[model samples]
Target: MNRRNLLLCATALAGSFAAAPLALAQDAPIRLVVPYAPGGPIDATARALAERVRESLGVVVIDNKPGAGGNIGADVVAKAAPDGLTIGISATATHAVNPWLYSRMPYDAAKDFVGITQMVRVPNVVVVNAARAEQLNIHSLADLIAYAKANPAKLNYGSGGNGSAGHLAGEMFKQRAGIYALHIPYRGASPAQLALLAGEVDFNIDNLAAAAPNIRAGKLKALAVTSLEPSPMLPGVPALSSLYKGFSVDTWWGLVAPHGTPKAVVAKLNKAFTDALKTPETKTRFAALLAEPVPTTPEQFDAFMASERAKYQQVVRASGAKVD
Candidate 1:
């Protein structure tokens, strides 16, 4: 063969080799592991993002591994290869509070995953059954507090369970507000909210999305929000933080990959997801679900999760909430 032809062939072979990895990455579908059951807000949001990011990341798939308070699904991502093919949803329960609440964890919440970006925040509303509130003559949070103080150990709140976010928020509220209200644990958030609706429990810090209908129907009177600011979904309702400075506890979930994933891959994932989050379509859809989209850089997400872990560590311990 001529020297020039030989050089051309060699260069082509090298180019193909260089292109192999990129081709494989582009073709391989990213499996988004949602640490919750299908059909909930988390799963719904994951599906929405999956649809939007498909153009950028190729075909992204949703894998629900819900169990063990999200530890089971999170562990799947924790143990996956760090080649950026497997991404998981990290939430307040999975990443922040569960580490302290559970005696045994499948993986380190802070170390097993690298944040890509924070996706959304779902505020919890402090609500009372309207009939029960009227019966008790409690019209506002202050009125409830006064009632609690006047009738110590009489006021009780319901939660999904002992270690659930609702439980922790209630505990933190009790501690921060300096009130003593018994906590009534139920099977799930639905049941807990039902207890409140039926007047079995005096009040509940319920997920806004779940409580919105009741609140709108005047069955549940929203006293305040657990978010730092009043949620747009609940107009006129004050934020608990406004009353108790810096008090904030709400459901938040973000995208994350295996801990050792390359920085370049992480940045790429962050950009794709954050871009999708900024779209008007995503914002409107998330608003319908009563979730506020919060897009942040990977470093910012890491910092946010770290702060959440620290804060929940204190809150979890204070509540004496634990799981085996």
Candidate 2:
């Protein structure tokens, strides 16, 4: 062969060799880690995306790592090999609030992971026990505030955990409304909701999904949702922002991979998941959970995380919330 032809042949062969491994890698099953127990909003949303991702990516598995207020599961993804095969579902609590809520966090939210995309933003609802509401004559946000001012520490509020989004939302409500209520933290939303239902706690700011059935069944009384607008599921309920101007607190879920994951892989994951959000079935599911589907590019997700981190830092300082 001529010298020029020889050079071209060699270049083609090297390119083929380099491309072979990547082709194989693309076919591997991607692992998506959910940093909470099954049945929670994060897990449900992750599984929904995973199903669609499997159709787009060929194979995907959802792995639930539920402990340490979601930090344990998040750390596993943070430390995993950044080969693009391992990804995680993280919420505002894990990425934005935990750093400020805990004196020491296991991983740096910004540095330890590269954001893929935000999947959904779920609003929380302020729910009171029907019995408690009737007994205390707490019929609305104004009534609740009046009761709190009158009762002082007599009224208590429950949350999912010390550093969870619900806890922060409750604290924000306390600070914004200038009310005094005892804060009770539980392992997760189930126990906290149970406490409110059983009258162990007077009220709680809880995920709308967990509180929906109770509210519909008349077991729990929903006064106002924590979002800027009223939730479609509970249209009769008012928004907290209506009571306290500019008041809004929401729990959101996003996808992330360990830092240094291949750019192509991250792009692929983002495309697959974002596309999944556009599907009619996915939209309906999100609506049922009172979670709005929020699909964003990686850059947008990163910017969102930064803003959330700053916002939560201010909230933590203002509320004086900390994890021991």
Candidate 3:
């Protein structure tokens, strides 16, 4: 062959080798792991985002890995290949609080994953069964605190599970109010809410989105929101911070990839998520759940995670909430 032809042939082969991996990577399906069971707020949020994400990236799958207080699903994603294709949707309880709450975690919250972006934040609402609230005359947080002080260990509160956001919020309330109420931990929020409705428990600190409808229907009476500011969904309800300074416990959800993922891939995923949050449909959906869509850069998200971890660590220590 002529020298010129040989050079062109060699150049073409090199280009193909370089482009092959990029093509394959683009075609691969991205797996988004939800570390909780289906039908919950996190799962619903994941599914909503996934639909929009698919528009940006062709194929995406949401795999539910529920167990062990979300450790099982989180660990699976944490240990997966850091090729950007495998990501996990995690909550404040899993990423921020788990390290301090669990005796021995299978994975390190900071070291095991890279934060892509924060999705949303939902306030935790303090609610009680309407009938029970009327009987106890616990129309507000002040009423509950007064009652608890008067009758120690008589008021029983339920939570999603041990070491969950609801449980921690209740503990924080106890600490701030200086009351002694019995804690009843259930498998998840649904069961705990059920327990409260069945008159098995006095009250619960649950996600505002989950409790808002019940509150509006008069099934549950919202006493207060665990946020510094009042929730739009419950405008009449007061914030816990109003009664006790700095009292707040809002649950947040975010997306993270396995540690060591390429920076370019993380940036791409962040862009997709940020773009998804910008869509009117997504914003409306998140709003419906009393969740605010918060699109942030990866570096910003990392810093936020660090701060949240520190905050929750203190709460865990204060509450002495731990799981073996």
Q: How many residue pairs clash in each candidate?
A: 0, 0, 0
Candidate 1 vs candidate 2, TM-score winner = 1
Compared with the true structure, model 3 gives a TM-score of: 0.90
Stretches of candidate 2 above 4 Å error? 1-25
Query: Which 10-residue window of candidate 1 scores lowest in summed lDDT?
Result: 17-26
**Per-candidate RMSD vs. true structure?**
2.9, 2.4, 3.0
Candidates by lDDT, descending order: 1, 3, 2
lDDT tens digits by residue: candidate 3, 67-154? 8888999999899987777899877978899899888999999899899999998999999999998998888889989999898879
**Candidate 3, residue 43: CA error in Å?**
1.5
Kindly indicate the candidate among 2 and 3 with the higher lDDT: 3
TM for every model, in the order presented, reads 0.93, 0.90, 0.90
User: Which candidate has the top score in lDDT?
Assistant: 1
State the local distance difference test value for candidate 1.
0.92
Of 1 and 3, which scores higher on TM-score?
1
For model 1, the stretches where C-alpha displacement exceeds 4 angstroms are 1-23
Q: Candidate 1's error at 268, in angstroms?
A: 1.2
lDDT of 1 by residue, 8-124 (tens): 999999988655444544679989999999999999999999999988889998999999989999999999988788999999999999999989898998888899999999999
lDDT of 3 at 43: 92
